[model samples]
Target: MAERNNNEFEGKQKNIQILYEKFVILNRDLLNFGVSIEELKEICFKRRKTVHTVQGSQKNAQHSSFIVAVTVVCAVLISILLKIIFDSIIKNTLGTRCLLPNNYFIWEATRPETNCSMCEDVNSVLVFGNVTRDEFSNYAYSSRPMLVKGAALHWPAMKTFTYHFLKEIYQNVEGAYESIEEECQILTFKTEFRSLEDVFAMPESRVLLEEGEKPWYVGWSNCHPDVLAIMREHYTIPHFLPEDAEHAHMDYIFIGYQQGAVMHIDYISRLMWQAQLRGHKTWKLVPPPDCDHICSGISFRVDPGDIVLVDTRQWYHDTHIDAGEMSLTVSSEYG
Candidate 1:
């Protein structure tokens, strides 16, 4: 029995030894697995850090691009605003200076003596009546101007010559007349064609006659021979003119209110006679440069039933009609 007990104890000790060896192997395998798991966790942490850094860099690049775009837009808008203001100021200053005649800066500097003592108060024009041909020749040769009373007072035109009468005669006639597009010197007068009916139909507002306003309508009657012939029947030739000049009938008719021709010298070869038939007109005449010593600028009013003979070629003249009514004057040119 004592021998059996000793063998059993040895067997039990072998079994215990086998169990201890299995525990040691299991512990080693667990340690190797734990090391592999730790390495994988470290790799995942580095990859996450790299992704975050790349996202931060991309976000910074996008923010920088947005800032640059906004700055460029603001610069373009400021430049356009300055250009508009400068152009407006230049247009107003130059346009106003051109319309004024007496106040023109360039004329004041260049022709300072134009309105000096020679343009002060002057005498009335010479008056004549029933002048003979010889008397007219003498006056013409001496370059004298005269106002003949009753030159057309007794003519049929005194009662019949009017805007309506003339319009009737030229209703269908194709004619050209002077028209102004604007109140500026560059486009003061231009020739336009229209029938007499169209002219009579123009609105009153378009025919400006007030001070500082440009006249819209003005013209000579020489454009149409038929119209000229009709005008000759109303007023007879002055007896003062020679027989050769009798056939030289009236060639111009001025029809307007409160305004007349601009200051200018006529370059035509013949002397001119204007017969006032309807309204009052004041004439302002300036002599030629050579005649300035003997004559100053002269101003006189011509009433209805009066005729004025002037050497328009040798004088600078302008006219102004009274404001109440439209004025009518028939004029002729003769040597």
Candidate 2:
């Protein structure tokens, strides 16, 4: 009887333990579900804040983009308006020539006092005197243009290459005159009957002369220092840069003649002081103007002993010759 009772009690105790385990599992599941709900609410709140921040940023970006577009449009419009205004003003100012007397007809010098009387009377171009040759030859440089009529003369330093080319010309040939082209020959302008003193002192030599029964040109060639030295033996001073002209320097003198009613072109570089030794030379000039297309050639006369300088790219000019005589000019290209 006692054994039966103990076995029944043991079975009852096992049932109680099983019920306790079932209750513990249900309680754990409920606690986990509650924690999950709280975590979901926290995530939803954070997402809301993030969405609001993104919306604000998008609105700011749109506003900034609109401002940039407006600024660009305004800038373009202003630029177009300014361009139109500037174009109209320039077209009105420079498009037409004035009827009044053009003052561009002046002597080629700093001062107009030295202009020849014949050159002064006409509306022709005039070349002017410069700082004394002595001043120009030295470092005492002046911006003054030597004048002929009332125009300004310009002088620039000579290039080293020009001197080299001159040396080549001298090294290659011999004679008093050399022909670079059949149409033009390098020659001297010597005159007779003038006092040996003044005649020898100047580089003026007549290029035109009577040969036999016809008037033929006496050609001079390959003018070198030795030839000039020889000529100096007969003449006085030939207005040339001395061998020791500078510390260690030399120069080349190129000769050109303006045929009757010929156009006087400005030089590429360097100021050309053209001395009128024989005959008269008329010049017309237009200062450097818009794009260099419009050429203003004013007429002017240059007389003997009158030095006129054409500053580099100064103007377009021309000359007229007496029926029988050729106009003589000496162009010195200085550095």
Candidate 3:
């Protein structure tokens, strides 16, 4: 009985020892797994922080680039605008400087107003420059005046010039003034041969002048060569009529101002330079409206040794002269 009791006790002790070893092994394995879990969690948090910082840096770089691009674009646009404005101002200044005659300036004074009494319903107000009256002259080299109303009628000048020119060439007829025997009358009004059509119209129409006892027509029909020859002698360079053999489609153009002439205006002419050889004249200039294309529309007039710069295609103007006065006006054209 005692030995059996002792054997049971030993078995119990061995079983207890085995249980303690198994418990120790299990506890160690549990501790290791927990440590690994904590380390993995720490690594994951660090990686997440690094990734967030990198993303934030990339975003900041993109924002900076956008700002720089915007600044550069703004600067470029402003530069372009300033350049355009400066260029326009320079061009305007240059154009004004270029407005001169033979590279020289010329001008004449206008007639003083006599008693503040404006002339009545001054008809046909616009003055044109570089216009030739050769087609309008009744006689050769005779200056023809253009009639201005609502429209400038150059037909009169053209018609008178053509009739006399044709008669002088084909009919070999002397002009009225040429036939006059009185020297005094010849000096007062002289004549030459030119077709009125040369200044105004086509040479297809026929006009009939009235018989004698009528006043001398303002247009050309006949003129004295001797009187013209005297006038020619005074010119810087004598301008004379060529023989019929020298006639061409485009020939001498007649241009001169009447002693007491009046003109109105609607538009300006290209350019002009005039010199007063004898008489005094007055001019009234109207400035162009800004909305109506001031640069393109302009005209010009002349006074003795005076230059008028006007926009040939624009502005309206007027001119008048006193009695016993004369003026020499030269003109030119441009784009």
Top candidate on TM-score is 1
Task: Please tell me which predicted candidate would have the highest lDDT against the true structure.
Answer: 1
Predictions: Cα RMSD each: 35.7, 33.4, 37.0
State TM-scores per candidate: 0.53, 0.34, 0.22
- Candidate-wise lDDT, in order: 0.58, 0.37, 0.31
* TM-score (C-alpha) between model 1 and the true structure: 0.53
Alpha carbon lDDT at 331, candidate 3: 28
Task: Report the lDDT tens digits of candidate 2 across residue range 70-182.
Answer: 33543454455455555544444333222111123322232222212212223333333434345335422222334543111222111111223334434444632232222
Q: Write the per-residue lDDT of candidate 3 for residues 1-335, one digit (tens) a residue.
A: 33554565565456556655754564454345342434323333222111112355766555445434433543454455455555544444333422221121121122222221122222323343443334322322211112211111222221233334433442343342333322211111222323332322323231221233111112221234543333333332111121331221111121323332222231222222222332344554443333232222222334443333333232234445543332333222221
Which pairs clash inside model 1? none
Off by over 4 Å in 2: 1-145, 148-223, 230-261, 264-268, 288-296
Error of 2 at 180 (Å): 5.0
Winner by TM-score between candidate 2 and candidate 1:
1
Off by over 4 Å in 3: 1-278, 289-303
Query: What are the runs in model 1 whose C-alpha is more than 4 Å off?
Result: 1-123, 174-198, 204-217, 246-250, 290-294
Supply the TM-score for candidate 2: 0.34
* lDDT of each residue in 70-113, candidate 1, tens digit only: 22332333233334334433444334422343332543344323
Ranking by lDDT: 1, 2, 3
RMSD of 3: 37.0
